[model samples]
Target chain A: MTLVESLSTGTGFWNPLAWLIAVLVAAVIVYLIRQRGESGYKKGTTQTVPFISGNPEPEKEMVHVRASNLYWGYLDALKGYYNFIVPAHTGVLNDYVLWYLGTTAALFVVVVFI
Target chain B: MFWNLPFIAVVALSLIGLATIVIKKNLIKIFLGITIFESAVNLFLISLGYRAGGIAPIFTSAPSTDMVLATPQALTLTSIVIGVATSALLLSFAVIIWKKYGTINTDEIRRLRE
Candidate 1:
């Protein structure tokens, strides 16, 4: 059978190609809906200010809040639940690596056992 | 029953995740939506690895003629790794946003630095 003829009918719901197309369509719809009637600046705006290496310019309407302050507000609202959460305040990349390792190990264990 | 159940669950989970990300305004919740999406893909990959009346993909003497597919297992592993990296990167950006504006609300964020 030719490849064209084979793919003529539905490949069934279980087909990976079908699933991928579904995902792509969903993503496109979401993006288009988000883009409707919005200014170009808001559409592609980056929240973070780009850091130019070693060139500190005049700050224009830039608000720099302390990391501690931000964490405190989020945690304060959490009340009893705040103690259980791990705060990702450390600027070091190693902490992220460790988090990835821990979560991956835990997920692997869960998948293997059940 | 097992052969088709996973496919149905994956599709359902994908729809749920897509809805969550599309409807939710909170950045953290959006990240959770992505996590859910990744989970659905992982489940799909795992389902693809299953084989009826088959043994594990291990080489042994007198091994069963039918062995579970190995490619999906590899794909699942890669998906999990990529999921971890993407989540970490997104969460890190969330942290930076919180530090910058002292607010996690996406609506509130838009009002600032205009």
Candidate 2:
């Protein structure tokens, strides 16, 4: 029985074969959609180079992207939140201890209340 | 409530150690606090298996077979052995930190470094 073949956890059931078939079907649909993409796009050329006001693309290393730059947009959006947090990180030993103790106390409070 | 004295002591020692670790800036003091906390944990383990009028877990020709659980005692011994090694390692780290940084003050040590 297909239903009996599923792994059950009382409230939920999962069949790996069924999941694989669904994923395969979804992949086929995605492939069909990709076929309708822009016809002007070529396999490999300067046309594929990122738009930089029609200027020659620089080398990969010349880009000089920092690790922090990867999350620049996210950090910029959360500037207000970081402004409050950055100043609090004094790196003082006592402050670190207090933060840990405070967190532990919070956990204990949650355990007792919940 | 009379039988809960050891448990209460375990709680008190743990809290005191945690407070010491949090409030103290000195690395040596923090290590001492860690030792205190480890001792508290070991005591807690020993207390868990305690029983009145209990003899050693060894199979001796005793009148009654009332023996406390030996597993917790063994675990406490192992904890103590590990605690000794941890204290030694932590102290060495503190020594290295002091040698490299000139000052042992945690606040001063947080200065910008290349």
Candidate 3:
């Protein structure tokens, strides 16, 4: 259990105690910084409203960002890849099973041949 | 044929599960399919450890005889724990999705795409 002397194990090694100490130091630093920062946030005030260059605030639903919209540019760039992939994820359970069966069948054939 | 029954059951169970996952439209049904799939895998693992007239690998007073492999049982236990956690997490996600989108239909939960 006390393998921390050199921590090497032929191929790789890890020191749990060292990692714990490092994490503790990092947490302390973050806590100190947060404690020192100005706490100027006030609820139900103009400060609470999101800044949008004086534009009228959008509806709450419109203002909220959904997960799907987060990667528009990346998805657009890889449109071809997504075109092939997204349809495959049609959210239909049977199609998903078909994919799994197809993969298993392919692997079985490969293993049998090999 | 009798000895091979468990292996055949594993295949049947997994295939049925896959079919359910592919054909089911309800989120809960899909989840049930996943659980079935997990059960089939667990069954397969447990079956691999079977031995004729083998005793459980306990170190108690009984004279040590041919023991069923303990590794697969241990692995199956771990898998069951993981499966429970996974199902809980997935179900929670489903609940959250329903609350946010007012539906549990995978097809309709495409808000991210917008």
Candidate 4:
């Protein structure tokens, strides 16, 4: 098999060995730095507890970060876009199929006409 | 009449799949719709290379009649494998969603939205 060659039509070339070497070098640097860092973790101490604005920590389940709660700031900033987009997602299976059919029909019409 | 049969079946199968996807609320039903859609696509591809009485491309004896094109079959095989993987991944995600949210209803699972 022809391996590690540039595309016949493109100028870009990729070599697997080069990528492997680069990744290894980067990993070694990260490993060395991590080894040198202070490992001051102590069990059964206040240091082990997560600090939450000086307030007593809530129960583990209560404090668990749910997937939906993530990226709050980003979502808030894009509230206008999400308002239009989120409702369309509806998590409805039929809606998803409708979107696909609509797109396919649109493409068919476009291809036939133009 | 017979020549257009597969093409008609392809369109019907895909339309049925799309309808199923749109009308179904259960996650498993939606996945089944996806599988049906994939089957329709694979059928369409295989039909594209159909010959009235074509022989397999593999040769072990003297040269004979024209063989059906192999590329589309290869592509359909690859697509089938990918579809299996995608369906498995989607079902696993469904399981995870049920575990985390205690329900599989898309509307009820909208914890990410404000």
Two-chain DockQ for model 1: 0.02
TM-score of chain B of each: 0.85, 0.86, 0.91, 0.89
State the number of backbone clashes in model 3.
5
Better of 3 and 4 by DockQ: 4
| Superposed model 4: Cα runs more than 4 Å off | A1-93, A103-114, B61-66
- TM per model? 0.46, 0.63, 0.56, 0.56
Candidate 2 residue-wise lDDT, B1-114, digit = tens: 989999999999998898888877788888899999999999999998887878878867656677766999899999999999999999998898899997666777676422
lDDT of 2 at B88: 96
Worst 10 residues of 1 chain B by lDDT: B105-114
State the lDDT of candidate 4 residue by residue for A11-46, as single tens digits.
676777778889999999999999999999989999
TM-score of candidate 4's A chain against the true A chain: 0.54
Assess the local accuracy of residue B23 in candidate 2 as a C-alpha lDDT between 0 and 100. 76
Model 2: residues >4 Å from true position, as ranges? Answer: A1-78, B60-66, B111-114
Task: Estimate, for each residue in B25-63, the C-alpha lDDT of model 1 and write its tens digit.
Answer: 677987888899899999998888777766888768436
Model 4 Cα lDDT, one tens digit per residue, B32-107: 9889999999999999877776787776752775666689889999999999999999999999988988887765
Question: Could you tell me which 10 consecutive residues in candidate 2 chain A have the lowest summed lDDT?
Answer: A1-10
The clash count of every prediction, one per candidate, is: 0, 0, 5, 1
lDDT of 3: 0.85
- What does candidate 3's lDDT look like per residue over B1-114, in tens digits? 888999999999998887778777778888999999999999999999888788889868447765666999999999999999999998998898788888877667654431
